[model samples]
Each structure stands twice: as C-alpha cells, then as structure tokens.
Target: MLGSLLLLWAGLLLLYFLWKTRRPKNFPPGPQPFPIFGNLLQLNLKNPMKDFEKLSKRYGKVYSVYFGGKPVVLLHGLQSVKEALMTRGVEFGGRPQGLLVNDINENKGVIIVNYGPSWKEQRRFAMSTLRNFGLGKLSMEERILEETSHLNSYIDKSAGQCLDPQTLFHNALSNVICAIMFGSHYNYEDQSFQSLIRMITENTKIINGPWGMLYDTIPLIRSLPLPFQKIFENRDKVKAFFQAKVTEHKETRVPGKPRDMIDCYLNEIDKRGNDGSSFDDGFMMVFLMDLFVAGTDTSSTTLRVGLLQLMMHPDVQARCQQEIDTVLGERKQVCYEDRHRMPYVQAVIHEVQRYGSVVPLSVFHATTQDTQVLGYSIPKGTMIIPNLSSVLYEEGQWKFPHDFNPSNFLNKEGEFVKPEAFVPFSLGPRMCLGEALARMELFLFFVTLLRRFQFHWPQDGGEPDLTPHFGIIQGPRPYRLGVRLRGRQSG
Candidate 1:
C-alpha cells in the first residue's frame, strides 16, 4: 500500500509539471519553466527590474515568462511597446483578473477594473467631473500653489538642518490630492492625515514586494493568513476613511452646487438615480480612493527622486535655479504658464522623470482579444507588462539614454523637446487621466521649491546611495539632505 501511494504521488507531480511548461501555439518563446514555480524562482521578487532586463536580453525584446503556470508577455524597447500599447491599444487594454492586487481592489475602480462599457463610462465621468472642479485650469494651479505654500513653510522650519524630506514631501502632495477629492486640506501635523499617507505609502511597497508576487503566483496559499493580508487591512482602513468623508459630504453638500470631486460624484448619483447607471455610493467610494492613491503616490515619489537627483548633481540644481531666477525675475511665485519660457527647468523635470522611471513596470495590462505583437501571437487573457524603463532608457530614442542629463530633452538651440519614447505617463486608451494635473503640480512644486531653497547631501553623510527602493512605484532610498535659503552661498 505504501509503495502504491508513493508511485501515485510521483506520477501526479510529473503530469502537473509537464502541463505547466507547455507553451500555447505561436506563443512568444521564453526561458524554460521550472516545474510549478515558473519564473518566480529566477526573479528577485523584492526588485525584479534588473532581472527583467536580463531576461529581455536573453529572450529578445518580446518574450514570455510564467508566474505559477501563467504566461505574462514582457514588452521591451520602443517598437514592441508602442505596437502593443498604442497601435493595438484596444486589443491589449484589458486588466488581468484573479491577481492579488485585483482581489484587494475588489476588481472595481478606474485604475484596475477590466476594460468594458462600465469602465469607459466611469473614466469619462471622472475626466469631466475633474474639469468641472478646475482641472487643467488656473483654478487648479491655485490649489497646487496653496499646498506649495504650506510645503515651503514646513521646509522653512527645518532650513539649514539635515533632514529626511520623505514624509514632508508626501504630506504636501497628499494635501493637494485631498483638496481636489474632498474640498479640504490637512495641516502637516494632523495625525489622521499622516496615517492616511503612511498607509498608502506602505501599500505601494507591500503590493510590489515579495509577498505580493507570491500572492499573485500561488493559488494554494492565498486562503491561509499571511503578511500580504496587511494589504487588505490597509485597504479596508482607507475605504472607511473615504466612507466617513462621504457621510460628511452627504450631510452638508448642496444638491446643485458641487464643492469638490466627492460632491460632484454625489450629484452624479442623484442624476443617474434608478437609471441602471453604475454610479452609486459604493462605487463612488472606491473611485475616489483610486483617484487619491493614484494622485499621491506617483507625484510624491517623483518629487523625492527629483530632490535626490538635484542634490547629487549640484550643477544641475544651480542651473535650474539660475533659469528660475531669470524667468521669474523677482516674481513671488511660478505658474504653469511660466514653464513654456523656462526651457532648462522643464528639461530638468522631464529628465528627473525619465531617470527615475518611477512606474517602471506600469500597471499590468492584458489582451482583450486574440492579438499579435511583433509577429508573436498573444491569446486573449494573456498578461502584458510594458517595460517603461526600457523605453525611457532605450538607445536611438534619446541622445543620452543611459545618463541623467537634462540635455537629452534639449535641442541644439536649448529649446525643450520631448522624445516620443518619453511616455512616463504611458500611452493608449488606458493611459493615466491625471496626466495634466500631475504635470502642472510637478512644474509648480519643483519651480517654487527650487526658488525658495538650495538642497545638498549632508557633509558627513558620506557617499550618497542612488539606488532606488523598487516597488510598483520606484522611490529613492531614504536619505537626508542639508537645506538652506537660496543664494546664501556661505556655510
């Protein structure tokens, strides 16, 4: 009996391994899978960017990798990514289902929901509603500048001291998002506000770390409690926070006069009442949460990366400041319109984004129908990972693809020029809707802060580590910088 049982177990294992390794017809070629583990064993779950680059080199620009018997097509370089995300966007626009992140998001919200009529409707409503609340207009600039003032004040309190500006920057950006979503801002010292920022930041790390990868690949261990459970816990807490704000808005908001995004969405629910529209209180809560989280994380991480790059290359910082001074010419503050004249400053900001590649592997996309990229077949439901880092640093696309030079964005005449490969906000139907707002905020906040202060690496801090703490959103490793009022020069 014992011999018979052992033989049966061995036979099942072999069958499972064979089934997992078989490639679909016309599928892109990839490295051989290792039994049930797939390519997970070959990757550094905590930071797989380098591993991905290595795989691409070995398997060509377009190749496949399996995560627990599931094949994910990785698109590298400008040609392949453009073909998939732009040329055949609608065909490759659907979001993957049954992943850990999908589960945590409950498969709702504009950012993660599968492509369909409902998603299209929600996205249109969000874009229009945001515009009604001053998006891409001077009124939106005023809102960002208000937060800039608060950010400046906080830095003023710590001027000439070595400090980690991570939390400071996060708070400023979070407040900007709050003003848009909730019609209010929070003080830097508000504990509740701090908690929200903390939780969202933590979620970004956890969702892209080892546990997130494990949860995505393995089906057997999901039901058992694990560290990844923290993601769901944090999600619940954030939902509760949004729900409270919704309750407050319901009690106080006027029917016709919308105060912010929330109020506008509430009015939308009333207008679509019983019309079979997807607009409702619960959907609104997750939608608002999506806007807030998406708005805060990417922008804040970019600022952190910007600060680090500026400090590491003081020459770049000084040049940006010189341009800022020349353009503003004693003006109290900078505006979005001023960016058109400040070419060098604009180049630096764009270079910072390109160098950082914050959203390296952008949110995973899946093919909506049977399609092919670069002559390779991709079946419906195959996951697509557009390697933005490849395009950001690809050869032939930029003058200096591997360096952190603002000149990459400048022509011989020193005019600002954006390369087609600079799709940091991504491309196609599912592209980020907040691109305009984010660009405005980055310009306003970067210009204002550079004008007010000069930042440098701490003298005793030794060699600065430029390595990023990789996640879904890449963030600069924690480090301290010495700050002083601009033009002081003397130590």
Candidate 2:
C-alpha cells in the first residue's frame, strides 16, 4: 500500500512539472521551473536584485522570472528601461498589487493603483492640487526654508555630540509632508506624529522581509495563527489612522481658501459634486499616505547618506562649504533658488542620490497589455521592474559608478551637468509623484545643515562604514557623526 501511494504522488508531481514547463507562446525565455513552486525556489528572496542582474546577463536586458505562478519581467540596462518606460510609457504604467501595498493601500492611492481612467483622473487631480498649493513656487520655498531652520536648530542643539540622526531627520522630513498634507506641521515629539512615523517605518521594514514574500506567495498565511498576522493588524492600524485624518479634514473643510492637500482635495470634491471622478475622500487619504511614505524615507535616507559620504570624503565637503560661503556669504539663509548658483553643492547632492540609489528596484510596474521589449514578447500582466540602481551604477554612465564622486556630475568647466541616465526620480508616466517636493526639501535641508555645521565621523572611530544597509530603501549602516558649528573664519 505504501509503494502504491508513493507512485501516485510521483505521477501527480510529474504532471504538474509538465504543465508548468509549457511556457506561453512568445513569452520571454528564462530559468526553468519545478513542480508546484515554479521558479520561486531559484530566486534569493532576501536580495533578488543580484539574481535578476545575473539572469539579465544571460537572457539579455529584458528577462522573465516566475515568482510562484506569476511571471515577472526584469528590465535591465538604461536603454531597455527607458524604451519601455518612456517611449511606450503609458502602455506599461499599471502598478502590480503586491501583497503588502495592496493590503496597506487598498487600490485607492496614486502610486499603487491600476492604470485606468480612475487612476488617470486621480493623478490629474493630485498634480493640479500640488501646483495650486505652490509646490514649485516661491511661497512653497519659504515653507521649506522654515522647516530647514527648525532642523538646523535641532542639530545645533546636539552640539557636535554623537547622535543617531535618523529621528531628527525623519521628524524634519515628515513635518514637510505634514505641513503640505494636513495644513500644519506637528511638534517633533508629538505622540500622535511619533506613532505615525513608527507605524510607517515598521510597515516598510516588515514588508521587505521573508514573511512579506511568504504572504505574497501564499496569502492564506496572513490569516493563519502566526507572528506575521501582526503585520496585517499594523497595516489596518495605519489605514485607520489615515482614515481618521481624512474624516477630520472633511469635517473641518474651509471653502474659498484651500490650506493643504486635504483641503484642496475637499474643495475639488465640493466643486465636482461626487460624480465618481476619483476625487473623493478615499483617494485623498491614500494620496496623503503615498506622500508620507515616499517623501519621508527617500529624502531622509539621501541626507543620511550625504552626511556619511561627506565624512568619508572631507575634500568634497570643503568644496561644498567654500561654494556655500561664496554664494550666500557668512550669514544669509539658503533658499531653493540658491541651488542654481551653488554648482558644486548641487553636484554633490546629485552624486549622493546616484551613489545611494535608495529605491534600487523601483516600485513594480505591470504591462497593461502584451508588449514587446527588446524583441521579446512580455505578456499582459507580466511584472515589469526597472532596475533603477543598475542605471545609476552603470559603468559608462558615471565617472566612478561604484565610488562616491561628486565630479561625476561636473563638466570639464566644473559646471554641474545633468546626466541623461540620472533617473532616481525614474522616468515616464509613473515617475515619483513627490519629485518636486522632495528635491525642494533635500536642497533646503541639506544646505541649511551644511551652512550651520560641519558633519564628520566620530573622533573615536576610524573611517565609518559606507556600506549601504539594504531595506525597501537602501541607507547607510547606523553610524554616529560629529557636528560642530561652522565658524566665520572657517567659512
């Protein structure tokens, strides 16, 4: 009886394997799959980029990998990514519903929604709202400068002492988003604001680990009695928090004058009169959540990496200081417009983003329909990931792709030259929605801090580790830095 049972199981497994091997006609060729698991067993769930890079070399720039039954097409190299994302941009603009993003966002937000008329309408509304709120205007610049001043004061209070810097940076960055979204910034120590930050950070961390992959593969585990269940509960808590904020914003809506993103959205809702145009409270809440998540982490991580890079390469730091001193003099506050004059400072900022390459693999995009990428047919619904880090680190694209070199952005005449492949904001229709806001914040905050103090490695330590700690967003390993007020003579 035991021999008979084993034979039956073996036959079933063989049948499954045969079925899985029958690839769709014209689907991109990739590694083979096994029974039940597909090609999932071959991927390094912890760090899938390495696997994807290796496969790209084998299968050319565009290749496919199966995550369980799902086929994900990895778009590598600059040309391929640009072609698919830019030339035929909107056709491949749909966002895939990952286990975490789906549960947390529920298809309401601008960032992780499907490419349909609904998404188009919501995105248009958001773009218009941001413009109306002075996102690229002088008024917005003043608000950012105010936040930068507060940040400088906090760092000055630290007074050259060893500090974590994460919380301080996060507070400043989150406040910028808060001011834009909620019509006001919170005290750095406010319990509610702190809780919001903690929840967002926790969700980001949890969703990038093994359990996240497990949930994606077998969603039923989310309901199973396990520690992973807490992740779901926390997700709900985050959504509820945002929902409450939405309700408050709606109840306290001010007509004739829109103060923040919520107010602006509510005003639009009033104007449109709830005609199912995707400009409702639910969309507003998700949009706010998107800003909170993308705005906070990417800017903070870049600033953290910027400080670390400066510490390691003091020469570059000194150059930046010289430019700041020359441009702004000893006592003037830095403004967003100042970036145009401070070429070296701008170059350093660009290089920090290039070297850090925080969002290594951009948020996953799905082809809205069957598409041809580099002569290979990618079926509709095939996952598309633009390996953004690959472009940032491409050998031919930068002077020193692997090293932290600000000169990569400088021309022979020492003017800051924008590289064609500098795509930290990504390219095409689904590019980061917060690009302008993030750029403004980074410039203002970084210039403010540099003008006030000099950042350096701890005196007791040797060179600090520049190796990036990979999470959903890549950042430097935890390291303390010494900050001292920049004296007039030093400037």
Clashes of each: 0, 0
- For 1-491, candidate 2 gives per-residue lDDT tens digits of 99999999999888876676667877777888766566888987766777877888898887777776677778887988899999879878988876667777778878888899878888888788778788889878888888887877777677757777788888888888878887677888899889989988877877787777777777656677865666667766777887887788767776868778777777888888957688776777777788788879999989898998898888998888888889998667777888899889999999999999999888889989878877778777777889999899888988888888888999999898999999999899999877898888888888888877888778776766776776668888888878878863221
The lowest-lDDT stretch of 10 consecutive residues in candidate 2 is: 482-491
Mark the regions of model 2 whose C-alpha exceeds 4 Å error after superposition. 2-7, 461-463, 488-491
Candidate 1 per-residue lDDT over residues 1-491, each given as its tens digit: 99999999989997888786788888999988877788889888778889988988988999999997899999999999999999999999999999887887777779899999779978999999878778878889999999999888888888888767788888888888899988888988898898888887788777777777788888788888999888889989999999999999999999989988989888988988898877887788779889988898899889999999999899999999999999999788888999999999999999999999999998899999999999999999999999999999998999999889999999999999999999899899988999988999999999999999999988888888888888788888888878998867635
Candidate 2: what lDDT?
0.82
Best-fitting candidate, measured by lDDT?
A: 1
Cα miss at 397, model 1 (Å)?
0.9
Model 1 collision count: 0
Model 2 TM-score is 0.94
Q: What is the lDDT of residue 321 in candidate 2?
A: 84
**Candidate lDDT values, in order:** 0.89, 0.82
